[model samples]
Target: MRPLIIFILFYLLCIQVQAKTLQKTVNENTISFDYTWQDHSHKTQTLSFSLPKKLINNKYRRFKRYDKDKAMNHIYKALLEQASSYNPREVRVQFKQQYSQLSYTIKSKSEKKINEVEQKLKQLENKTYLDFLKQHHYIEFNTPWAGTKIKPDHKNFVIEGVDYLEPVTQAIRESISVKKPRVLINFVLSWLQSIPYSTLESRTESSGLGYYPPIRVIAQNIGDCDSKMTLMSAIIKKIYPRLSQSLIYLPQHALIGFQLPTLKTDKYTTINGLHYILAEPVGPAKYPLSEIADSSIGYIDAKSYFHEII
Candidate 1:
């Protein structure tokens, strides 16, 4: 009896996984995606879009893995290589933990020698920091977003991911009969919301990559708040090239806001004399423009969230 119950649970889990798999039909010329989702009105809608196969092959041929320890090791090796380039007998550099913080210690035969070595190390460290981020395809960010400690390169995701999605954005634009800003934005949101929602793991976790870039999110048909926001930002940018945008990070969730006309009842934030009407694009729960998850309202109302211009 116990075995039967366990087997049933396993079967249910398998069904859930299979259901989330995106249905795509690939041909020599293009890859077509068919999606069905419910709109804010609780009405079911279907969308079909296709991407030129060549675009996928040429533009997003690889998915990058984000591993903090691996990246740190690479940086450490670089530092050691730089240090070895100096006369080992004259200068030595060591990394040590003091009061629960790690810092560099320099040793030399004389104070003058140590000072010289320190200057060189400083220059190398600065250059290495930027190089490591580039090599790892990450951008540095600091935020208090929930379930996050190491900053994921969300800026890189937004800026870079936007380029590959023009074909998709154009397809969406053509599908919508009404070209109104709200209408198009809501349509995009509903499509994203319908995709399987996967919780973003912490970067510190060794088991999974915490953040998914926009293209990866679409390819996998699963995303959390940050990933969806990144995709939405890219789509909105393509649709309205001149539109100003910002990404809002709440304690455990994320949302996007656009610099556009607003009404008295709209939820918005002001930056540099511009109004950004906030929109919640991360949904299995439909939130139309000017609406956000109830969980996020306290953070938004109290202004206790981080905001970044994209």
Candidate 2:
């Protein structure tokens, strides 16, 4: 009986020590992780961020099954949300089981630099507007005038614009050397917004029978929602051939969507096992890459398309 009692006490002491060690680990607030990847420019970069212990504990307890992959995905999703707020042009996250590690890469054009370019653009706005008018030979015509009616095969038109937008593609590549898709999309958005907005009826003078090619839209410096979205889609397809993109038809309006690895918000749709976030191209109002306007939500009827440059 004496030997048994001694054994039981020793076991209890060991249990207490183990529990204390676990408590110490759980109380730690941060986990250090190393991230390494190549940027859009093919330059290798490394960075780090603190993974919150609280998040891990909460997810672990809730998942109960404690799937490492699921837990890692949650971590990646959180990291994505945090990174996106800073408006990185591109971000990719991966998990490696060999080291029980997470790695990610971000390519972001500095906001300060973009802002400086914006200032310069603003300074030249008046001159640019005048130049556009003079070069395009602006003409004002009556709205809804009986212009020639032509039914556009929308898909074919968009596909054909791939070859037609070479000049615009060249201009984009030259102006912004960063090849990050999101940043390039934003750059396109800014350029489209710079053009004055006009309805198809107003510009074409043929109500409900007006569709212009992407190049025509650019040269004229005016277009409706669909025209701008078509231009954006063409430019994106030309530049990032591998990235998945789509045209979302919403009520009488149109928007663009791009497939991303993971999206935290409900404002997305899945296509062929990939997630795509909605982006507005017809904006005097600036919207982020995947964000839609408040008025445009819940009434959306989206369609997905994958265009190959070949």
- For all predicted structures, in order, the TM-scores are 0.82, 0.45
Number of colliding residue pairs in each model: 1, 0
Candidate 1 per-residue C-alpha lDDT over 1-310 given as tens digits, one digit per residue, 9 for 90 to 100: 6999999999998567446435688888998887766688987767777777776666544645565566656666777788778787888888754443335889888999889888887887668767876766665555554343445567666777677787778778887899999899988988888787888665433223646678777766778888899899988987887889999877667889999899998988777788899898777788888887778888877878777887
- Give per-residue lDDT, candidate 2, residue 75: 51
| TM-score (C-alpha, index-matched) for candidate 1 | 0.82
The residue ranges of model 2 lying beyond 4 angstroms of the native Cα positions read 1-151, 200-208, 301-310
Best by TM-score: 1
Candidate 2 per-residue C-alpha lDDT over 1-310 given as tens digits, one digit per residue, 9 for 90 to 100: 6999999999998566334322222236764333232323434433233334554344212211113344445555555454445433432223244444555433335666556544543444334433433333221222123333222334444666776556557666766668777767766775565455565443232322344556555544456776787778887887777777776554356677788655566366666666777777776666767677877775543332222221
Question: Lowest summed lDDT over 10 consecutive residues: which window, candidate 1?
Answer: 201-210
What is the C-alpha local distance difference test score of each model? 0.76, 0.53
Alpha-carbon deviation at 34 in model 1, angstroms: 1.6
lDDT of 2: 0.53
